[model samples]
Target: MRVSGGSTGGTPSGGDGRDRSDPQAFKRGRKVGQTVRGRLLAPGPQGLFWVNLAGHKLLAALDHEPSLGRELVFRIERLEPELLLRDITPPPSAVDDPALLLAALADARSRFEAVLHRGPPLFAETGAAGPNAPLAPLAARKRLFDWLASTPEAAGLYGRLRELLRLARAFLPVQAGRPVYLPWAFPGLDASEGLVTRSGRTFTLRLFGRLAEAGRVSGIFSLSMNRASYRLSLERPEAGEGLVAALTSVRLGHRELAPVCVHLGPLAPAESGGLFAPLIAGAARPFTGLRLRV
Candidate 1:
């Protein structure tokens, strides 16, 4: 059976499947109160430039998972375009009806809007002070969506979303608005780097792979940086399966083949209880605590 993220289980053979376990895979999962890092590597310069484009949400994700510190870095490389194409599965209906393609585009746009309109963590209904808040996870997610939608360059983003959906459909089913994750299905990157902390102890992580990227020199570079920074954060020993699921759920897109490298270091956890302190202080207040229903 296909795994939840959409690939057949047990890792892909011949470089066409996911790496079920990292080359450095250990028997243990990360522990609470430990620091973690994750990095993604894209084949070209584009990946590197854009890796932290989602910094707003990334920081929030790290905050939610305290085990993850805020330090992330992206190292990128250049590669050939054809090699990148070799990573993704062919779309079952890419050449179907033009109308259908347009409809899919429309669907993708709408989903993007929902994510955009949600705004930032400070505006979330379940903000840090809210009963359902986990250090404002919802709000942070909102900011990420907004940032992507609000970029000044419309044509570029259009191409990006189109490519992302096409790739998403190839590897997994796209529910009009659900997040999808595409592993190294795209060919471009050779490695992703990050820091791993177990029981408060830290270790550096380097992951190699074949990832896809846009053929354009600019696009390749942008993607490289983005992937490197993004994936490296996952290296933390405390990173859990849920966060992994959420990340892999992001839409994957087409790009040129290129080399991608991620560098993560100087990783550190936020001050202890830094995120929780606000909630604690709010609770200590006489009226604010009373007004908020536990």
Candidate 2:
């Protein structure tokens, strides 16, 4: 969702004094049977719960009291007389299951790779040409959502990937230590950020995605306390001299920074295999007494 301001407080009231903050009215264009993601805000009067769904606060009656500030997923059961939501959020134990984590990581990697192969341009603009350039992270996210609207399937995949990543970040410590995956605006592009080796101030990140025009692209970005720089490696048929030419003059604001672009001949598997290597390695270890039957 696009960033917005202001906070909603107190219970909303209708003319008849009944609570007016019904979730049905603020479904955010979602229909019944569709799942909506929200966070548990606080308990309301009369045993109702206040929830923040898509930036709007609505009241819901829950069977069990979920922890405050916990993200929840609910399927819209009804929208007529009253809005009913079924809590579909997975249990913490299930989220921490190695099998589930591996499946999620594999699914995300495959989906991202598929999107990179056939989806729209990763960036609104490649910043290949001078003047109008690629957007910053936040603006890029807005553009990404705007692009995803036209492609519903892609948007759904993005939502699932985002949820899985969030769950992984929250529940899986082994996978979260290094190469922590965070949500990126561009579909199929897994971006990870962490501190550089032996350096507290230097941070590094890598982005992998495909451009409709550029085939497969991998980018590495390094940022220090003051300076930032990036290198983009491309793998496309028939050579990308023109695309490279356009990228040479890319700008990140008013200041022009030199970005290195390398041609890696043909793309090599997109690095999806290594995305969850650590998790897989951890999960594959044999238990103390576990054995397979012949």
Best by TM-score: 2
lDDT of 1 by residue, 153-262 (tens): 32233333445344333322222222222112222221211112222222222222222221111111113312322333222324222322322221213322232323
Q: Which residue pairs in candidate 2 have backbone atoms (N, alpha carbon, C) closer than 3 angstroms, thus clashing?
A: 128-246
Model 2: residues >4 Å from true position, as ranges?
A: 1-137, 145-159, 170-199, 237-243, 248-258, 261-274, 277-282, 285-290
* Per-residue alpha-carbon lDDT of candidate 2 for residues 257-289, written as tens digits (9 for 90 to 100): 454554344455745334344444355332547
- How far is 11's C-alpha from truth in model 2 (Å)? 24
List the RMSD of every prediction in angstroms.
27.1, 9.7
Local distance difference test, each candidate: 0.26, 0.52
Q: Model 1 reaches what TM-score against the true structure? A: 0.19
